[model samples]
Target chain A: MISAYVTLAVLLLGLALWRQTQPDPGHRQIAAGGWRQMRPLLVRIPIALIAGSFLAMLVPRELVASSLGDGSGLQGILLATLLGAVMPGGPMITFPIALALISAGTGTAQMVTLITAWSVLALHRVIAFELPALGWRLTGIRLLACLILAPIAGLLAMLIGAART
Target chain B: MAGQTGGKPARNGPPLLDGSTVFFVLLALGAGLAVLLLRGADAFNTALADGLGLLLLIMPIVVAAVLVGAYVQAMVPREAMERWLGGSSGMRGLLLATAAGSLTPGGPFAAFPLVLALYRSGAAVPVCVTYLTSWSVLGINRALVWELPLLGPEFTLTRLLVSLPLPLIAGLLTRGLLHRFSRTVT
Candidate 1:
């Protein structure tokens, strides 16, 4: 995850520098425009990740695993996905957390569910990024989509996990 | 045209690129580096080095998505997007978008940049929503990698069943609400 951030930063910086040195005024304008468009996400995503990391660490991995771990059934999958929606972190923290849960003997299904929820329905991204740019209606719809799909995605992941096992 | 090449109305909106943008890129990079240091430089370095490999893995899909986005942007007009795929009666559009999303190739990370380009190219809200949702949920690649290898065939089938309708559901609900609001105002 950290690597991803570094990668993104370097890419963005390269893009900016390229923009700065553009010979065409219009090209510079375009590059500058892309940069502006990306600003909020660039700023807020890190903050979300930071806050998410702390929150992820605070939650007991054992507790999470137990409640929505490997032994957890379909119901558990649903619960785990719901839990994921509330846990706002990046792939870095979430992936590690999920791996820990799996290692702890949590159901692989639960891991998938958790990841689906985390990636799709994170409240931090919703509040800080989506709502402001896309407007309430759009954000609300996205939230609805995420919440509605999370369980299904979890269920699918679990079923696949189960079959493999 | 979504402020495309020729939308320069002078007062269209704010200028692109600024100090804030630079700061954000710098900050994100700094934070990422910090994360690497905390985790262990050797492990982090190796992982970071693999980022390009990952990028290469999804390059084809990204290129396809970009072409699709550009085509959609060039061809789809605001009136058309609104009429067939806009807010209220845009159910078909939503479904189409969801289907397109389900078919998108590659991993989520690889797809992000291409999707961002789509968003920039005046793609509809529901379409973007569906695309993002379906990209992760029902990618063929995941079926091969994570689903088949780890989860087995039955579970993979079940997972697909569950994920199939998500993009549609998301797209419809989002479009429905937006349409409703738009109607209320007019």
Candidate 2:
């Protein structure tokens, strides 16, 4: 069902792209301007990936799965979020590891926080591209917001899970 | 065609080769091989087995993101996205910001281009903040891929239940702070 929604959304967005690409100058101008502005970040992503991959090698998955594994609560969430920020895996690695951690019996709340931080506050991304592009004020503000919200989201996911079952 | 002379690359093109694609390809291969050698074929096999599905899932997402990125490039004028689900009333603005925030895709990086488009097209500071704050916390993308698989149906449902409201809270608080800051400037 969710996948269907995503498929639908992607298809709609694709159609939107096709429509926008028509002979209108406004859309073309927007695309051109966007490319000019975002070039720096595009240049930065591969560096971040290399760095993230290397870092992923150092932190053994067992430690991550154990320390913040299924049983841990708010504390685990806190730890996992920070760890996720610093540890430096993209969604490709993080998503599966998150599942593995859950299967290993990590708390749902903790997983929620960890995943939230992983996606939003990835240390590699923050350092390599985000801070530079958005600036310290906005970057700091967003990180602070994520820090506060991730735990709550984690808790909410857990609570929701509990209610459903 | 008219602006074809701009020569600048498309912002949404494949990102793999941006900084150092060739190097990373080698790195990914090296890393994979290291696991194969040190941990033997079994360890390499396990990592791939565990990791492959997510990589597959994200492929479509990344493709879609790039395409939406192109559309966002062309259409969806920025002002519209930031148009606050509500007007001036701070609380109302906050609620609207939150709802709007949840729907945008990509992380901060993805939002970067979109937000720039918004600002260029005439978005407010508070609305931008709300949208950005929402992008990080809410996982419309992950909610589709990671959350469903990892958390199971019950947990996935619960997360959507909880996450749906977060942008509102975050957006409101962010707007209030930015509003206060702007007011002081004025």
Judged by DockQ cut-offs, the docking class of candidate 2 is acceptable
Which sections of candidate 2 miss by over 4 Å?
Answer: A1-62, A87-93, A96-105, A128-130, B1-16, B20-27, B46-79, B82-89, B106-110, B113-125, B139-158, B175-186
How many backbone clashes does every candidate have? 11, 5
Per-residue CA lDDT of model 2 for A47-122, tens digit only, reads 3333333334434677666677655666787787686677564554555445555655566667667766676567
Give the alpha carbon lDDT tens digit for every residue of B1-186 in model 2. Answer: 223234535455665244344455565577767766767777666666544543444434433444345454345444555565335535566556665566554555666776666655655555666666566556455454344443455555555566666666665556556666668733
TM-score per candidate: 0.46, 0.62
Model 1 sits at a Cα RMSD from the real structure of 12.3
lDDT of 1 by residue, B72-111 (tens): 3223333443333233325666676655555554334444
In candidate 1 chain B, what residue range of length 10 has the lowest lDDT sum? B62-71
For residue B104, give model 2's deviation from the true position in Å.
3.3
The digit string of per-residue lDDT tens for model 1 on A65-137 reads 6787667687787787777888753433344344335445566566667656765777765676566556665
For model 1, the stretches where C-alpha displacement exceeds 4 angstroms are A1-65, A157-165, B1-92, B99-125, B135-162, B175-186
The 0-to-1 C-alpha lDDT of every candidate, in the order given, reads 0.53, 0.57
